[model samples]
Target chain A: MQLKPGGIAATIGALAAGLVALPAAAQQQQQDAPSVAPGNAYDQSASDVDALVADSAVLYYQEDGGRVRAVEAETGLAWTGADGLAVSGRFTYDSLTGATPNGATRARYDQDFIGPLPAGGHLPAADTRTGASGAYTAPAGTLPVDPHFKDQRKAGDLGLTLPARAGFRLSLGGNASWESDYTSWSWRVGLAKDLFDKNTTLSLGYNYEHDESKPITGIPMPLGSMGDPAIGKQRIKRVDSLVLGITQVLTPAWLVQFNWSTGNSRGYHTDPYKLVTLTDRDSGDPFFYVYESRPRRRIRNSLFLASKLALGSYVTDATARWYHDSWGITAWTFGLSEHLPAGRSAYVEPLVRYYHQSKADFFRNYLLLDEPTPTYVSADSRLGAFGAWTFGLKGGVHLSDRVELYGSAQRYVQNGKRFYRDAPGTMAKVDLFAGSRSTSLVAGLRYHLR
Target chain B: MSVDRRLALLALTAGTLALAACAHDGAAPHLKLGARPWERDVLARKSMQLAVEPALLAFDDHTYFSKEAAAGGRGFDGGGCGCN
Candidate 1:
């Protein structure tokens, strides 16, 4: 049964009372009862890792209309040491191949790479070293992409948790990732405390991340004229974040959590490989292409709330979140999942999610050459106003008390307007949602070793 | 409204919601012996845990971060890709 808003309020009140009243009605006080621990580094959980666990997963993703395809595999290991200390490590590898939009309009003629190919070129394109080397030479009236585009990445993570005095837990985590032209490192620390007989957990966390990128053609000059100077050095970006969260057990079968996070990032935010086309104001004909530019600094904040409700053998998980950034973009996300038992050792879960976002103030699909140039402009579809929905199903089989197998499949679709603004001129029409549909499949296994 | 103003308003609204969700009666509800334990039993199951699938969930987070414009809410902010 779902709890009505009023009923939830009443239940919350009861929980407050239960904290102080020390509910003697608790029949078993099951040791396995879920703790009000912060679930992640941002949300600290108070419980100690008690077992050695290993998990592995493989994921396959394909975007509709052949936009992008990716395959990924990940593994994780966690073990508890003496004195309530836990250590964990994870590794992941991702291989992505296929075409991604170049933010350029369909060309009226087949355009060759702007420059010549490099010796021992890895890709098939003749213009291997040029900015367009790997780019697809679009046929007239077709979107351009580098059909031979490919990228691979590998990442590793390590974490440690230490239980301190007075029911406080401290956690530290670090990560490093490497790709052909990009490298990143990050670290985080968090502290969590349990109060009111573990009914409530409060946590505070901080994170820092550093990234370096040296694209195939180096850093393109934003909005630069043809033959502009390029920065051949790697670009750096950094982010700092702080989060505050709380998890509460509202009742024997109800759990709720809330988190608030603020983040600040500095350095180049532009996409080196992505460019937007300039169209003639009168004819809407493509003229030239220039790389996008964004503000050097960004500040973002988000609020998240999640709840879990148990009904007999079934449980429902729900989450809602709101996010905003300095770029004048706002977003809302909602998700729900229901878990039901199919047999003694098997269970199935169905999930649904919805997301909506407002466009950035400077978002543009294509620039009109006659119009005044903006200091910041991006034709990236991700920054445009859009709505997306995802639906999926997941199931798991407990092969034994020590081993479990799980798998999931999900489909996502996004919808948005193709044109950024209504201009009186006849513009080249494009299908903004051409790459909107994607399917993701995941298979995983978890093993617990005592 | 300006971005700063919108941010302030959102922060205020979020604060209000948190307070409301946590609102409780000043007095604790005293429980007598022997209330039903079925609900507790269900909640104690591993499947009922909020983070039941750690590895898969982490993978999902990365996938969305790469594809979406918004990121960061639950916690760790490790940079993985240049364009992401």
Candidate 2:
């Protein structure tokens, strides 16, 4: 039987659920053993049972944006003994100003014959065009540019887990978010199991997500016939995912892990807020309007591997990932972390990461104002190929047995290749549609009540 | 049961009895039994182990989720969201 996206997700979810229940069965069998001495056995049983109780922890965080403030709070508990279970959950609030709530748009062309022709060379008659008379007579050149829209959003999540025994554990979780114009929900479940005397662990997981958005009322519709008008009002989308993984503890001081995951998404994938121009074939004039509804589906797959090793007094962690999707996008990522002790009371960790992605299938540097084209074309930056790098340092210091303090700082930059550049032949003239650079800092303290 | 099979079983049983008789010839050791090695250290450091630092792990989760492609310390690729 062929496995659809939803089917794969469901299968993985079922596997994870089964893994979570295995530990309870093992614990039951262990409890049936006969006792040797009354007092000693009773005391040993008390300690063993007490060790299975769950441990608890809490944390708070704040994220900074130029005009937006984002915060998160989380609480977690884990049982350590026979059952070996863990559960963690978190809630987040995000607020943004000068944020573009409305989505962005993009369009592309196979080839533009923008010759250095005189202004009076050719023009199209206004009456022959369907909408927006200006589009029929406007020059073939591109528009100057417009300011991006602003918007806001808030989101939250919760996660639960059961630890590995004989090397097995189960994980499950969900998240939801809401904005002025849109709402989304996602859920996931997973199971991990170890084999070969705890040397190799395998995991399988699945996720499902749904998103919907409503257009603002009273906004005037664009004057164009290139894209579907139905997209201007309401939007709906869905995605299902599946993941599989393997981990190996090669040695006492070395570990390696590998993972592969796939996702299939369907429905409205284009942003409604952006617009594209079409060019008249005969007159070279351009048309100005919005390209709205386009139904599309995507398939994404990824491979990731990471390793950790102890180097003298410090530990080093390294990871690499490769990703590809049906949208004609491919990407790679590399990251590293090093931890060093800062005297007896403190420790420091420095981290660096780099990422790069290729452009989407329909990505275009620019679109003409007046043009008639096929159904598929987009310029969304999220679909485009891009590269980014981030560097950060984190440190922690112990004040006493009950209290500790820690903090981190990070800087990020997006490479120019992420944007389009003018090239020869079939190479379209592309430019940076938009880009951002920022830094983040966090600090917090932990207190033990027990 | 066959005669030979019964005789083999009886001989095995007799040998087990002989071993048991020899074991009873010795008395239990006089030295006192104590806590397991790991248990002793755990009890000695009891005061330092009680604090649950939930927040620190939460911060690590968020940071790693947004920045790293491979997560789950044990080697799994996490889902990609709009958080980054």
Off by over 4 Å in 1: A1-49, A107-132, A419-421, A432-435, B1-42, B77-79
Q: Can you give the DockQ of every candidate in the order shown?
A: 0.26, 0.03
lDDT of 1 at A1: 16
The whole-model C-alpha lDDT of candidate 2 against the native structure comes to 0.47
**What digit string (tens of lDDT, one per residue) describes model 1 on residues A1-450?**
111457434534543443322212121221233222322111222243578989887777778777677777889898987688889999988777667777676545664333112224334233332223353466766666656556778899999988677799999999899877789898999999875555567889998999888776657677764334465557888989888887777777787888888888998788876776787887767777777888898888888898888776677999998888899999998999998765345567899999888988988878888787789988787888889898998766555446656777789888876553454254545443323578887777778786
Single out the weakest 10-residue window by summed lDDT for candidate 2 chain A.
A129-138
Docking class of 2: incorrect
Q: What are the candidates' interface root-mean-square deviations?
A: 6.0, 12.3
**Tens-place lDDT digits, model 2, residues A293-332:** 3336877667777776654446577878877767677788
Q: Candidate 2: list runs displaced more than 4 Å.
A: A1-82, A99-152, A163-167, A217-233, A277-289, A292-295, A369-371, A417-433, A447-450, B1-84
In order, candidate lDDTs are 0.69, 0.47
